[model samples]
Target: MNASLLRRHRGFSLVELMVSVVIGLLALLFATRLIVSGEKNKDAAVGGSDSMQNGMLALFSLSSDATAAGWGLNDPMVAGCDTSFSDASGYALPAMPRAGASITPLAPVVIQSNGANPDLISFNSGTSQAGAGSIKLFADYTVGNTLTVDSKNPYGFNNGDVMVIAPLTPGSGKCTLFQLSGFGPPPNSTILVNSGGAYRFNAIAGLPNPYKQNLAYIYNLGSPTLMHFHTWTVSNGVLLLRATELAGAEAAGVSVTDNVVSIKAQYGFDARPPGPNPYDPTPGADGMQITAWSGTMIDADSDGVAGSPGDYQRIAAVRIAVVARSKNAEKPNSAGLCTATPVAPTVFASSAPAGVAAVPVQVNVAVAGDTVSWQCYRYRVFETIVQIRNAQWRP
Candidate 1:
């Protein structure tokens, strides 16, 4: 062998060494890119998982309350053209009967009470005559009517008294209404007219007003189910729903977490003047009107809307709206969930980008569309039409 050939074989050319280094560096670069890509993918998966969890949590919270929209109502407002929960808010009644709570009407629970059209009321078993009974009052309910108290204990009533009719049988919450004959103790014929107590009603769900006598809970549709009912007496002139000092809802099934800042509604009553048909709009006279709602009920109705030939209903119905704030936010007192201002229902709806219906939407992305992640907050509304099927008394 030649000495030069042996030396050449023993040592690598500079080009070979350089090529080897370049190849090694290229391999390192590719490996680094793969590692980085793997890490990025892992992070993306984790972020997606967290977003799903957050949404699930929000859904659970909304579901719990939404399902119970109108619960605990036994003979709720009857389903009718102008009755039930829908008549007022065009929505479902709350499962529970609490203040600032309402639903749309399904039927009309007509009211009446007068010489020819008597106003009736279901007896309160706990405090009705005979302890508990079901009686019907008739002030020509079919036509029109109203009433005034008996000058003696005229306005406002006591727990148990002998003033008007009683339920003929036992009934549920609606047992408070019925039409029976006869007036208090004296059953007089000479002193005819009875004094009336401005039977004003404040059904957070757009129910009838000032429950007078001769009223009926005509629940003629849906399954015969029982519901929970309660009363918020105006003890001492201040209104407050009897409630537990907790997050629990009132008898009008509704709930709120500490995370919920506030929930409120307004009552709008139709008004009319003194004249006759198609009366004028008075200040706050039309049948105990309630409107300008914002978690509050002001005497907006001018006490004019009658319940007779003029109109068998005082409060035509109410326009209920609510405002809720998120209890928790990234920043202290930050109203990122929703503006802290009272957004009018009409304005809110109209202000929304056009082409959207006022209803619950189920979106299922099609095969072709923008593919991106979203984290948005929404307030759900549930509504239904229920009626006063039967005003008969019950257990």
Candidate 2:
């Protein structure tokens, strides 16, 4: 009776216990793998979101500035001229030359291309309170620090306002920038650019050339501190800005955004007339349509010289692509190479516009000097075409 009772309550064998332990271990291993996989996916999602946010911010900043370009300088005489100015504070315009020009054109937008790297874009505009209208010189302004305007008020010209002296004839091929210091005693037709007060842009010498009366106009560019002459570029995976009016001669740029690998841009040219005519009968007139896009400003009107004033006047829009990279470097595979990116990204890849043969703009995404290979990262491309409204609507 005792033996039968013991047999009925006997424990399980070693093999059965080992099988249960193995099952428990297998369950734990599966659960651990599931958690790791979920974490990796979450990381990837977060990284992508960061890239998207940064890209949008970068694009918006650039587009906003591009839209307001050539505000007070939209006149054909002022837009493409080689602008010259001296600053007492040592401020200087960008020394990097345009593709085919020696001096920087005083246009709405100027793009300086750097092969296999990010491009530099400069935006020139004025914040004049009296709008972008020009005030004719009352008398000849020949080789002096003072300008004689039509009336005493001179279109709300303030003491510290910046002004551009543009030749109405366009034959001078040059524009000069100066700061307004004050006005003559009572009937203030004499605008002074004297080197006194807190002015920084006025040089002691005065205007570089003698601007003749009835052939030139003084364009008020609001306060000297409010002038918008900004240059944008990407360096060391960050977007940077240098304002000629603010940061005067400071080569170290202000940081705009980070994780940006490249910035590619092209000029959207209104190269043709309204109908089938290849050239505009009126070169610098309105009603021109964007027929092609290019990196270097070409002879849009088939003029003898490329990057002529007519070519610059036809710049109605700019197409830009800003590339932002994921913050986190992706993990590598068993072969010790990252397959996350695997290939370089292409920019300005949209199909050619209706009549254009091809969009020749290309972007190189192989970033240099990274601990991890550039292929081990993910990227996002933000693209948009910003119209130069100020340029387009100018009279």
Candidate 3:
């Protein structure tokens, strides 16, 4: 009884042990698969979210600067006179046109640095409009370094602050742009007495009677700012914001946001016939329909002239599109020379020129040494229409 009972009660046969081992291995394999799948999904979701943030930030920055295409220099009291701009503020300001027969004011907003590729846009504005603080002039002076503000106490102004005094009254005076030496009997006082030399605002010809008549404003352009010229573009898969004082020249680009593949822009010219004056966007029409929507300059007068007064001045607004992509390269996606499908934002009724069907822009990207398809990466498109404020104010 003892031998038989002991033999029957032995733990189990080798076959039973083998079967149990196989079941355990299968369960472990299933669990491993579930964990791996979950991790992959999480990575994709996180990557998409990050890409969206980057795309959004880039769009916001570009749109903000575009809205301010033409600000402070809308119409200077003195026409075709020289004005200073600030460069230390990390922006690229526009330069006046070279001496010519007719006074050709610099285009408030200009797109340069590329023909059809990534385009760069630049413009000028007041310090406060450009995100810098501003102060009001308390009283007017014939000529002096001392600038008195209406406030008993000067708020948010510093010693090295660059300031601009624009004429509130039509015949008051010219807009004076100058840098502050931060000099005053009492530092940072209500009256900011710049230690620098006198401003050349009144030196120009055709001076109206009184200098500072009404509420002449004092704006902090920036300490080292001559003029604020803000530029936006895309290079090396990143969107950049560059600033410079000279025209058509920009320093090294600063990466404002990442994963930006390309930037496309179109100009809207006001070329409608003289009538009730309807300002509308026609997606796929030529001539008076869309007027001219291209990277190149428009022939606003249709006089076969380039860079003419009628051309640049007729630009009413700008439409821009920014494309961003995911950072992570998914395993399913193989990389080489990938062609990103066209991406158009809602603002654009069509991508191409007038009469042409709107299509997603085809982006040719080089992703070498990676086995991934361009389609494997997720992309986000941001687009908007920016109305040139200064241009609108024009009669």
| Global local distance difference test of model 3 | 0.54
What does candidate 1's lDDT look like per residue over 46-99, in tens digits?
544543443344334333322322221222122111222211112122221112
- Each model's total of backbone clashes: 121, 0, 27
Runs in model 1 lying further than 4 Å from the true structure:
1-13, 76-213, 217-395
Better of 2 and 3 by lDDT: 2
TM-score of each: 0.28, 0.86, 0.58
- lDDT per prediction? 0.26, 0.76, 0.54
List all candidate RMSDs to the true structure: 16.8, 3.7, 10.1
Off by over 4 Å in 3: 1-8, 75-105, 113-117, 126-226, 244-250, 274-292, 333-360, 365-375
**Residue-level lDDT tens digits of model 2 in 1-395:** 69778866787668888999999999999999999889878878988998899899999989999988988877767777777877665545654343455775678888887755799888888999776767887787667677787778776788888888888765365788888888877756777877755777777636776777778888888876778887788887888887766653335568888888888788888766433433332344446566788767677756566676667778878888899998888888878998777767777777545665447445566656778888787899999888887876555
Report model 1's TM-score to 2 decimal places.
0.28
